[model samples]
Target: MGETNVKLASINPDAQKARDLLRIVIVGHVDHGKSTLVGRLFHDTGSLPDGKYESIKAMCERRGVPFEYAFLMDALQAERDQGITIDTSQIWFKTEARDYTIIDAPGHKEFLKNMITGAAQSDAALLIIDAAEGVREQSRRHGYLLHLMGVRQVAVAVNKMDLVGYEQEQFDLIEEEYRDYLRSIGVEPTFVIPVSAREGDNIANGSKSMPWYKGPTVVKALDSFLPNAPLVDQALRFPVQDVYKFDQRRIIAGRIESGRLKVGDTLMFSPSNKTAKVQTIESWSAREDFTPPSEAAAGQSVGITLDEQIFVERGELISHVEEAPIETEVFKARLFWLGHEPLTAGKSYKLKLGTFDTPVTVQKVDRIIDTSDLSNSESEQVERNQVAEVTIRSRRMLALDEFTSNGRTGRFVLVDKYDIAGGGIISMEGYADQRAMIMATKSTNITRVEHGVSIEERARRNGHKGGVLWFTGLSGAGKSTLAVALEKLLFEKGYNSYVLDGDNVRHGLNANLGFSPEDRAENIRRVGETAALFQRAGMLAITSFISPYRSDRDRARAAAGDGFHEIYVKADVETCKQRDPKGLYKKAIAGEIKEFTGISAPYEEPDSPNLVIDTAETPLEECLETLVNYVERNFRV
Candidate 1:
């Protein structure tokens, strides 16, 4: 659009300085002109690196592809070959008034996971729509995702105006429809511009072609756009990314998402929930008394030194003692399934929220929304690229907030076994209010078989208290053998003890379970819950299993609570086969068992085990002695 006196020089420098740089991501369906808009903006602003345009131009000619504007931003070879942006690309440009970091996101549905990754870091969004095509499936879906991601600021760039004959009616019609759609989902676009990115009309510079429709060019609109500052003055919330100890100082570095952080200010760390006073505020050789939530706020990296030597770690949030963050065991969230496989309930996966990664299970699927109609559908499971409202139960208690309130801590990604399959944002907290919903679904039936009293009371009764001795090793590595020996030793010491061997569980408890990855996850979940019950009943629960996945072990650790002790029954695979107590390894080699741990499947060794017994070199009694000693040291009252 053409607007007079809207030159770049007219922008206010003070406004630019006060506002933090908002990184906006432009995303839409394939052939939606996302790249062209970015390329035009760069060309209009004279920010294209020298010789880059000519290089892309020559490559396009040699490759027999058209010298299109999209080629300018397609840096990846796969993108150039496929004629589609497969990965998100970042480009830095400036308007007269403000600096902008534009992220060009991939448009293919297959790469939607990558798109979400890019969206996770963006402050706002620019949704591109084709004027002639109106709104496509991806155009609507991406907008929905942006809303779900909590990107409140949006602008629709209706491209291909030249193809539509620069018609005012076409632009207005598309804008009106999209605005209605946005309103339905609680999103409102600040501006809607009609432009031909290919022709460089009404982008960085105003075009003479659109005289009938007068509005600020894309660049001018961006420059004039005011970004909301971080609420640093309100309650302080700092999520610690890391705590480093150098020389004598303890340095904590993280983004302060909401409140202001200053030197000498006292902050409480969660999970541990310890309070520590800030010693100094430091960033890039600049020391200050206070730092506001500007572009320079929470998103920008900062470091601080605290006065106390508290037990602070990564994944813990720091806040004012008064507001103290909420810690919960289970919550409801809206997840977008991006994996090839369907997301099924009761399946355990790695849940990564903020900097914390723990095992979690999808308890139930509440409702699945069809992207085309934006209507809710009753579904048993959500397939790839589908969005669903699901209830998730974390293995460990987590500190989280609503996505609308705090995007940083509310968002989470689900890692299926090894691959990250989907992501979600916390929509509602506490338990679901629907009693019927809970009744319709099956509970995680962990048998609470009480021989007499509860584990806590029993531990108090027995002179030597009860706790879980988690034994992890290869199938034939004597995990069960050692556990049985330890159980007898504990029993002889007048302690109530029970050994939950893998084979024994498979016979009764996990009778329906198989060796598949999904089944393995369930197996571990059941075992963890059982161990938790046993620990509560004051009985020494010795669980011996491959356990295979680190996420599974982490879940067991959480379920076992404070008295959980992990013992690595370390033995090489070859040595394990030499023993071959059940000859299962031999059968596995004969293809009798598929997805066997240490063979077809993976086994993640505990990185920081409390006890490591090398059964390969050490004798049985020696290994048991080491484990018993370690357990006695940590769990003895």
Candidate 2:
């Protein structure tokens, strides 16, 4: 960072027009000389502030200590005393090719989350490895995270080569091993060079001691990184950061996250589903009055006024309406856990994406990924520092784009209580019709069917009112037996009815689903939608399933809308074990089954069921009579 680029940019007006800029992050393990390398880069570029170098050198001389180059980045006196970098610090430097912003991230395990924050914002990265230590755990973990964040350009610096006697053989071994690991994670290193940051070899100049090794200096390698292509060809996604009203006009303010914004372009705000035309652009300046620029590209901060007054607010994404974001309550994401507590299903966290924040729950954990070798396995939870593919459900609707499509609107962070517990990227969308598929039908302009035969007519012909009776209980609780008996009794009475058995559906409609909690919820979802279809044809839909979770059952009821009956065909664990005809209870008790609800996992009892039949005590005839009488009273129109 020269004095001109660091402090005298305004005075040198010509330099401001040079828009070639790139941001890169320096990451590595603790005590691996990341700060030293950044300090060396700044020193060699003459970017340090005036008197900054002399003061540091004088301090080292007075203390009778060798001046440490890493001290330049560890600004805190306590940090220098402790010999570690605590937080991410941004330092500006320039090469003739481009202006560079280097984000020096802490390499400590505790601050790995902080490192993610900086890496997520970078266009490229420099991974520094210690030659003496070879490849460390963080060397792989950090590289994996960089790949996860979509940073493909990387340059690895093998530092502290002087400590290894500047041996070419030592550099080759370390270089080959680390390069192979990068290939496994789908990253081809732009360059890997051995350097001694402390001795200033292979940094800004060539090294004579290691004449056998030949490669571009670290500065040249960084310059070789390609600049980010212009995002103008992409769609506009200017997320609203805030709305400000200085005196009279309300200005929607935020950085253009991607694409471009210009006056007179029609824009639509997402999640809010509001639209307005951009009337004028506004920018702040030192002058009393200034002309607003005609356009604002990505990375520029500008405000705009709409032609007509609208309820514009934060958390709303701005884009062209024709290519709007997907507003949904459910999505799939790959998340990296960082909280003290492991990420568990059913627990709630706050998710913040762009300017939007909402309550989030890990509805299902598909699998946990081992960062070291990229192997994956089925996991019930993701522990701290672990990565996993999971399904997340939000309390309210959020407009999101897949990270493969748009990086800014596709990223999110999970906050457990007040601290950020994890971060993820949106991968797949669910409930695409609206926030919730069942709820969106009420808002859409979908043309309602005008059937030639009315629902009343169909019920009259069938001699019964349309309804759904959901039977839930523990396995071997006689739910299916009772449902079969009810179907016979109802059919004998000449009333239209049908039965949906759990295992029967799994054999066909839900054949692709597994026994995972997520699959179970989806199974119930499919059954609920199917049962509703039967009710639409004036039939009594009797569904027999364990239906473990109350949340899943509630969604079923909500989808049914009305005439939804929740009957708990209750039985104690011991009684179900005694009556285990299929022997599932024996397997579950012997630990042969995974995610076996009511034995291994959970079975949320309904708070207020329409009916409860304790099959262990209630007589078969008595239970049948109770259900028959209840149905006649409710559905005998």
Question: What is every candidate's alpha-carbon RMSD to the true fold?
Answer: 16.2, 8.0
Tens digits of per-residue lDDT, candidate 1, 601-628, equal 5565676988888988998888878877
The TM-scores of all predictions, comma-separated, are: 0.61, 0.75
Runs off by more than 4 Å, candidate 2: 1-16, 231-233, 245-248, 285-289, 429-463, 468-492, 497-537, 541-560, 564-637
Local distance difference test values of all predictions, in order: 0.77, 0.84
Q: Tens-digit lDDT track for model 2 on 1-637? A: 0111111001222434675778999999999999999889889877788898898899889989899899788888877888888788998888767889999998998888988988888999999999999998889999888888878999999999999999999999989998999999899998999999999998888888789877899999998888666666677888887877757888787777778767788887888787899987776643556556667776666778899989987878998867777776778887889999999987899999887888887888878988888898997789999989887877777888988888788899999979999998887532233433333344667775776877799888887888899999999999999999999999998889999999999999999988875577678888998998888878999999999766678888987878799999999888988989999988988999976766766666676999999899999999999999998888887
Instruction: Highest lDDT: give the candidate number.
Output: 2
